[model samples]
Target: MKRVFIIAVAIVTLLVSAEAQKQKVGIVLSGGGALGFGHIGVLQALEDNGIYPTIVAGTSMGALVGAMYANGLRPQDIFDLVKAEEFDKISKIITPSGLRRGSMGISDHKNILDMLDKYIPANDFDSLKMPLYVCVSNISKSQGEIIHSGGRLHEYLLASSSIPLVFEAVELDSMYYVDGGVFNNLPAQAIRDKCTYLIGSNVNPEKYRSPIKSGKDVAMRSVSILIYENTKPGIEMCDFMVDVPVNYFYSPMDFKHFYEIYQIGYKAGLDYIKEHPEIVRKCKGKRPDW
Candidate 1:
């Protein structure tokens, strides 16, 4: 555990170093727009489907956030104000221009992943296991633009939990976010990239690993659950891969914590990718030949 933590930190530190070496992009704001980058996985997905960002996208922001938190910011410092519904306080701490500018709305996190291709391939794009009612109730009662600000708020919560958030995990939240409706459906554009899906009722026979074609390492049933140990080739039969522990998803954290774990894993994956772009390409491709 200690070694894993150390390695994760080291990777993040290296990514930050690389990011700092590059010149910062110009902030094209509407007089006071605090800029943020899109998630890398989302970017890869977009590229896979022939979609790319117009102005640097969110990948840069996700990378920068990873670098910043791993180096400059502390989980406690950002969260104290956020839990108090002080979005500005959290943003001010991270954003030099004193705002989130634009986030999780017009340029949401998941939309980015659904558009790109990850070279490494991942099973992180599965359904979410959050408590629907609590999330919606919180969204309705919350004091902000429920879509954008609320999304950012969830991000704050994720950061506070010491879990790194990423584009892929954020994508899962669009359908499974705390406030996301249970019976409600996603918008037309949102599910556009779901070109293919698989279903297998009995995967217990051990020879049924098929649906999931992307070969990946380290999969999770959710934020608190570990589906397979690092690099274990999960079962595959037809259109879906099998072998992740279902109990992992049942362990229970509010929708917020689930998102946090997703963030942590996604962030780790992205950091690994930024420092390892080749890996992202394969993962985002969905069904890689490798």
Candidate 2:
């Protein structure tokens, strides 16, 4: 009788452990150019609370941050990289005259790609520390493309962030690809099937106020409007959402205010975690190995 009771207790413990392991958590990051820095802060908050994602999906700037994080970079590591002077040089826009004649825009896409190659340790999907889904706008198909495997990881990351008319499109397998924001700025749906729970970080401003100023403002506001409309479905999919507070003044091209933007995201993340303790409880089941 004693032996049977011990065996039953051991079996129950094993079943509980297996159930915990089965809970897969995913985080979806949205595209917001320079504002994407905020995602790092949110990631840090999640890490601090012992919550780690089993999968990560992102579009545009979100793709850059999410890929780096999923590739084993800590939030602080990414923050330090972006705050350095080297990143400024890499992210700089080429002068119009320096651009190839009749090119789409002034950004030197090669510089960003080179930076990614140097920083990201993995060259392909099979080696990534965790599963990552990068979203890109497929110009040939006129839709969003979710890249989970194949090809160089850095190149795909660049393709996901290649802002139309600002940076040249990336050609892979004869298909032209650009910023995923053009289609799905918030791509929670890409990883919905892969995880049982979802968390999302949105840095795009809810709405642009009046008194639109420069051409840059117009461009930012126009894109923000589209992101606002498109993000609704993705927002609905998230079990927990961290809406990073940002305004129209935060230009996508501006990389100078890293601390400010990151802090905002961190606060928002902490606030959400505090308000929804259940999310933390659910996520505690699976901690990232890295």
Candidate 3:
């Protein structure tokens, strides 16, 4: 039943995202969840890019990390505990904490998180208000927004479909501090000062305006836009990410071959969510708070 529900949710969410691109380019955006910390840089970069894109940040604890914990991999704790290629321990964490992990709100304290959160001061986000202090989570989704990642992931899929991209906040899910608190989306306060229903947090109408918001999760109202088809006339365009590389996708970000690394990451993200439909279909589940 759960698997079937998840697949159905995945199909619907992807379909909706696929369908939203009405203009020259259809853009979807999201930040680090499946991965961690670096996603923030990606978001800030998007913000810095003159184009104002709709930003939808999710809570790391609720839909994003909670789901992972429920599934057992303890995804939020990945950074602090496993410093390097510790895939074995990672896989093990998921197995024990999965929905099948038993128990209620929290499954096992003995499970690495307790020790990691307790002994390791790095994972906690109290009083740190720095650039990446809101590290509690990588992706954003609270009790209500299960489709956050899927929605953001959809943006990348659009690029893969070759729809003539203007700008996309690519592979943002695996880039931020997943286990910390995030009030700083003070990375907060929209720079555009004022925006429309679709515009995001960092958008600046006087600039490379985008209808995306950087801190929320609701989808945009369907409207006509000549976005990706062609960069609007007079709109100075730039693709800073071109040479940026795929290293961001594979943490400890390798400066070696930037674009190539991110290129791989970009594709991997698309393939991952698409291949694992069950994982994405979330919202419908009974949450702990409820």
Candidate 4:
């Protein structure tokens, strides 16, 4: 009996060690306009604590920040850039004049394309240190058809972030691309089986009250860590937006509110990392081997 107990303990130890060693991580970002901006703080906290993901998949605004971060840009830098910019500039991008009669009208496609040209120009995503899976829903196709790749990256980001009625559907490769969030706000599908661990930062509030509804929904269900507001304890998830208001995009930006919201996400991420032994074992300076 003693010998059997000893062997069982050894097996458990070995299993834990193997699990610790296989820590390739993936991050999923959900869309929610200015509210989605909170993901920046969560991402910064992850990196600050050494929880780097091997792959990142994002929808809408989450894609904007996630792709930028994957390309080596810092969260604060992205924030600063947004802060310095004028609201009028955003208003210009969303101007109704940019849209014309079509299946999906009322778009800011042209202005947004111009902005993309001026800011994040054409780039080969494969050149980045980490792989970035961009999420986009096809507006011209049957319900639930998604385009995960195939075109200029700028086009992907712009299309994924373009909110219907707010930002117009983007025309690319002869197809109209709209926000990926329409079909799957939590675009964890992009990660699929590509990594050992997945961390999904969901900005949408409806998931708290609804069941997983789409392919993206099922993908989010598979993530190792899902961060959202008012979320009940699940397989493995965190709730940080509990106090933050759900309606953030249409509302005007107040620096105080933005800072508060940012800190809410940051602290939530920081605390989660600090509490997880599996994550803390491989701190920032000591990244797990790929």
Candidate 5:
């Protein structure tokens, strides 16, 4: 009888240990314009390994992807949306007013807003399946704002990704907002306190290998330098990071290379997962065939 009691106690203790080890994982996605499309591939790889984020935080392009995922659209669905020719038309169709913006931006904000309206199912944070924190730069205040709620979801997405000089700033509640990458490109700090484990995906290239030939290239390279400098702190906060190898040649507006970039992201994610067996162990019983 004593032996039976000892065995029961041991089993209970093991079960308790397993339960305690189950952690709330949060993913932080960094901004990289069209390179951000790679985030979808990383997310797909995570799902394939049965690792789903309990919370997600992002800046700029990251915010757009994170918001869609938080609304319950699978990565594959997002991939399809981005790869479709319709997306190319909508994103590139510039209005005469947009072209004449002189110093504001070359593209129309309404085009992307219309795209978001058609795709995203939810309009508010509370309605989402998972908590999503979107980081945007409050240009009026010269500060970064982390938006977890309030205002329209699509507007927040637009504001978060509104690249300075490329797309016009989004106005919300009488405040002007622009790309979050100008402040915090990798917003790991936003979800650091919310999750027990953190995963970060950085799509920015480590260095610019090509010459800056155009005004657009100059803007992109300048932003890349700023984002790269500010990303160190966020990198240190992650338990694991998937670094997608996007290069200088792949401009922010290179929608044509979305599939190639996405595949690179997937491979990077798989490589990270293989290297971190502890992550796999933690997600036991949930593993899917890769």
Candidate 6:
């Protein structure tokens, strides 16, 4: 009887291990300022429900949180970090002059980079426990690229978050970089073919569409189209699009608004997964072949 019990326990352990290996989840995070910070609650809800991504690809602010998550920080910890005054101080550098002149005068860029490094040192993306891919806009070529294999985490984060004139373009290895959203807003294309399942945590509302009228608008739209076409295909897609007003992106970030944004994203994500039982089932290791 003792031998039989031990065998049963070993069998159960092996089954659990196999299930874990079979589950390949990819989380795609979108850009939206303090809006993007809402991803914290979305991630929290997923984790609460036993859903954790095996891989993650994020744009702009999403990349910042994703990088921290990849480095082993939990959602609550990320929230705490953001709530800290130190993080808010970084945004103060984006002045009206910075936007008009295309320069953040003081190079708070360095300060931002330094702060991130203090908490999470620059490490190879491939070396992270869970692989994280950061989507960045290649300014020189006006294209989108995923920084997955290896690079300074700070550089990747900076490149992904640099919102054109608002935040000065970062120079690295002789190339200028800007926000990834300019090309791929949600960055769904970054991990489409790399995983069996994908969860797109988008802060941008689904109904919001760009009203393009000018020459520059057309060019931006064209770039978006090209990047969208290049994004990989053939993955199970689960979308969580938060309903935030267009004006919110232009507003200043504060604890009150941050909390509200988080609630909006968290509820949307929770409701989405609840309605889509298939997504929940996949995350919990119930689907083996799909």
Best by lDDT: 2
Q: Report the backbone clash tally of model 4.
A: 3
Provide the lowest-lDDT 10-residue window in model 1. 25-34
| lDDT for predicted candidate 4 compared with the true structure | 0.61
- Candidate 3 Cα errors over 4 Å, as ranges: 1-58, 61-90, 97-124, 127-290
The predicted structure with the larger TM-score, 1 or 3, is 3
* Tens-digit lDDT track of model 1 for 54-162: 1110112222222222222332322332234332223222323212354332223322232121211221211111100011112323321112122233342221111
Model 6 whole-model lDDT (C-alpha atoms): 0.68
How many residue pairs clash in each candidate at the backbone level? 47, 0, 66, 3, 0, 0
Q: Report the lDDT tens digits of candidate 4 across residue range 1-290.
A: 99999999999999878766643777777766666667777877877877676667777777877877776666777666555544224454456675566636564566556655655554667655567887787878834343444448887888888777667677776888877766666656556456566677754444333255688546544431233321222113321122223232222223335555566667657766756655546434444342
lDDT of 6 by residue, 50-72 (tens): 78776788888889888888877
The TM-scores of all predictions, comma-separated, are 0.18, 0.85, 0.25, 0.68, 0.83, 0.73
- As for TM-score, the candidate ahead, 3 or 4, is 4
Ranking by lDDT: 2, 5, 6, 4, 3, 1
Off by over 4 Å in 5: 1-23, 88-97, 101-103, 205-220, 283-290
Q: Could you give candidate 2's per-residue lDDT for residues 110-157 as a string of tens digits?
A: 667666777775589767888889999999989888888865888788
Indicate the TM-score of model 6: 0.73
Q: In angstroms, how far off is 93's CA in candidate 5? A: 6.9
Prediction 5 global C-alpha lDDT: 0.79
Off by over 4 Å in 2: 1-23, 88-98, 205-219, 285-287
Displacement of residue 38 (Cα, Å) in model 5 is: 0.9
Over the stretch 1-290, how does candidate 5's per-residue lDDT look in tens digits? 99999999999999878756544788999998888888998999898888878679999889989988887778898887775525543345344356773546766677677667777655778887778999999999999989897658888888899888778778888889998988888999998877778889988857434477889778767767878877778888998888887654576677667778788889878888898878766643442222
The lDDT per prediction is 0.24, 0.80, 0.26, 0.61, 0.79, 0.68
In the predicted model 4, the residue pairs found to clash are: 50-284, 107-168, 108-168
Considering TM-score, where higher is better, how would the candidates rank from best to worst?
2, 5, 6, 4, 3, 1
lDDT of 3 by residue, 1-290 (tens): 99999999999999777655322111112122222222222322322322222222222211222222222232224332333424224342333342343232222223334333433324322211111111122233421112222122222221121111111212344532222122221111211111122211111112322345433211211110222121121122211111112222332213233234333433443343355443224211222221
Q: Report residue 83 deviation for candidate 3 (angstroms).
A: 5.0
Candidate 4 stretches greater than 4 Å from native: 1-23, 87-93, 99-107, 110-115, 143-150, 206-257, 275-277, 282-290
